[model samples]
Target chain A: MEPILFTLFGAIAVGGALLVVTRKNPMSAALSLIMSLFAVAALFVLRQAHFLAAIQVIVYAGAVVVLFIFVIMLINVPENRLPIEKPTVYRLLGVVAAGLLMIEGGLASRNFSAPATAVGEVGSVEAVGHALFTDYLFAFEVTSVLLLAAVVGATVLAKKKI
Target chain B: MMGPSAYLILSGILFAIGAIGVVARKNALIILMSVELMLNGVNVAFVAVGSYMGDPTGGIFAFMVMTVAAAEAAVGLSILIAIYRLKETIDITELSVLKW
Candidate 1:
């Protein structure tokens, strides 16, 4: 059951990601990214990170994607108005560079071997919350400050006359 | 069940594809989306590693990452909007004010 779920959702996630990069239409690409994010959330569930799964849905699928759609709609770039690139050598070089990156990353991951240590299960809401409030408390509080700064920065950037 | 390495490899592919999107695409919005893709890819690997080690740290780190991603999206979109208001376009190539 777990294996099947993994295969199905993994395929969906990767396929949706592929669609996201390939689609010319920003709206369509955004929708595909949303789908991909949902599938990744499923992967998180399979990993027993139930709280992360929920947060993934709420934060990414709900908020981030909506923000993207809002901007895409707000700007309203028609299909023909999308950026057009000349068939220059740089485009080919970019593709080659990315392909090399993929290869390097794949090889590195394949080489990573960790000893299988069996221990108590983690990732439940209670366990994660304990970790967050205890060992991670300082970082958690700092994140709040970072978020506040981000909010202020965004507001200032969006303002016309600052 | 698949090993953690399989998940890592999938994540690597996802990240790489996102890199392709970022490097190859012209639209800044798509580029930002690709950046999100790259973040997601890393998130998978982090969760997989945490699960393998029976630790909640991976999930905690992922939470931090999500928070950062949201903050980045907010700031990035606002900047994109300001750019659009000025040049009437969000093409990264067009906004080469920093290009030497």
Candidate 2:
């Protein structure tokens, strides 16, 4: 049952990713990205990182995906105006290169072995939060600053005549 | 439970697809979305490793990655919007001002 859930969600995740890349419409691609993100969140749940999974859904699906769709709507590109994506030789080469990279990554993944350690479920919200505030406190504080900068920068950049 | 290698392979596939989308796609928005996908692939690996290691540090790192991803998306889309307003097009191939 456990492996089944993983396989199902993992396949969906990969399939959604493929849809995201293949879909020409930005809205379709963005929506597919939400599906992909949701699948990843589900995978997180399978990993016993329940809190992170919820955060993933809230941040990624609830906020970021909506932002992408909103912009897509705001710009309102017509179907005809969408970029003409032809299958050029160079693009095919790029695909080949990416494929080679994927093969390499898969091969490398096989050699990974976790060091001998306690096999316990440690992804609860409390556990992860403790680590964030205690060990990763500096990084946590910096993320807030980063987010503030991003918000301000987005506002300025997206504004007209600024 | 599935081995970490399975999850890692899945991440590899996701990352590969994202890299392909970034390189092969012409639309700027799609490229940004692909970047998100790549980040997600890494996040999966993080959580998977963290779970196996019996520690929460990997998950902590993933949380940070998520934060960065959101920031990146906000700024990247803003840049995209700015580019569109100036050039009135989001096709990446034609907007080659940074080619120098």
Candidate 3:
């Protein structure tokens, strides 16, 4: 049952992500991205990472996608250009790179074995908070600094008169 | 009885498709969406590995990735809006201002 659920959510997430890239309409693409994010959060739940799952939905599906849609609407991309074309060389290079990446990933997967422990404890928010403050305190502080930098940089870049 | 390998492979395939889309598409918005797809693919792999390894760290990393992705989307969209205001077009070909 667990495997089945995993497979189902995994398929949904991958399929939605593919749709997000393939869809021509920007709005449709954004919607597909939202679906993909939701599916990924579901996978996190299956993995017993409940805290991660909640953050995935709230941060990604709720906030990021909404911002994407807002920008899409604000820009109001004119439909004057039906389809944009890329160089054949670019397409070929993309294919080659993707193929190589998949091959490398597949080879790497063969060497990995499941860990001895079974992850039965749910990754609750409290647990994650405790872990972040205790074992991962330095990393957590660094991430906060990084986030602050991002906020400041974004503000500076978006400022009209600055 | 699908194993972790199956999930990993699926994630890899999805990531590949996203890479293709990013390179093949000429619309900047679409390309950004493709990048998001790639990020999602990575998140899927992270969760799968976390579960299989019996470690919650992977999931925590996945959340961090999501946070980064959100910031990326915000910054990217703001840049797109700035470009659209100046050039009035989102076509990648038209963005040859920096090309020397």
Clashing pairs in 3: none
Q: Flag regions of model 3 displaced more than 4 Å.
A: none
Report the lDDT of model 1 for residue A16.
94
The CA lDDT at B62 in model 3 is 77
Choose the strongest candidate by TM-score. Answer: 2
Off by over 4 Å in 2: A115-118
Q: Which ten residues in a row have the lowest lDDT in candidate 2 chain A?
A: A114-123
Ten residues in sequence with the least summed lDDT for candidate 2 chain B: B1-10
Write one digit per residue (lDDT tens) for candidate 2, span B1-100. Answer: 5678888988888988898898899999999999999999999999999999898999998999999999999999999888988999999989998998
Clashes of 3: 0
Given the true complex, what DockQ would model 3 score?
A: 0.61
Q: Model 1: residues >4 Å from true position, as ranges?
A: A85-87
**How many angstroms is residue A29 displaced in model 1 relative to the true structure, after the best TM-score fit?**
0.7
User: lDDT tens string, model 3, A1-162?
Assistant: 878887788788878877876677888989988888788788778767788888888888788889888888887876665355636788788889899989998998887777666555637777677767887778878777777877877777677644
Q: Which pairs clash inside model 1? A: none
| CA lDDT, every model vs. true structure | 0.89, 0.91, 0.79
Single-chain TM-score of chain A, each candidate: 0.90, 0.93, 0.90
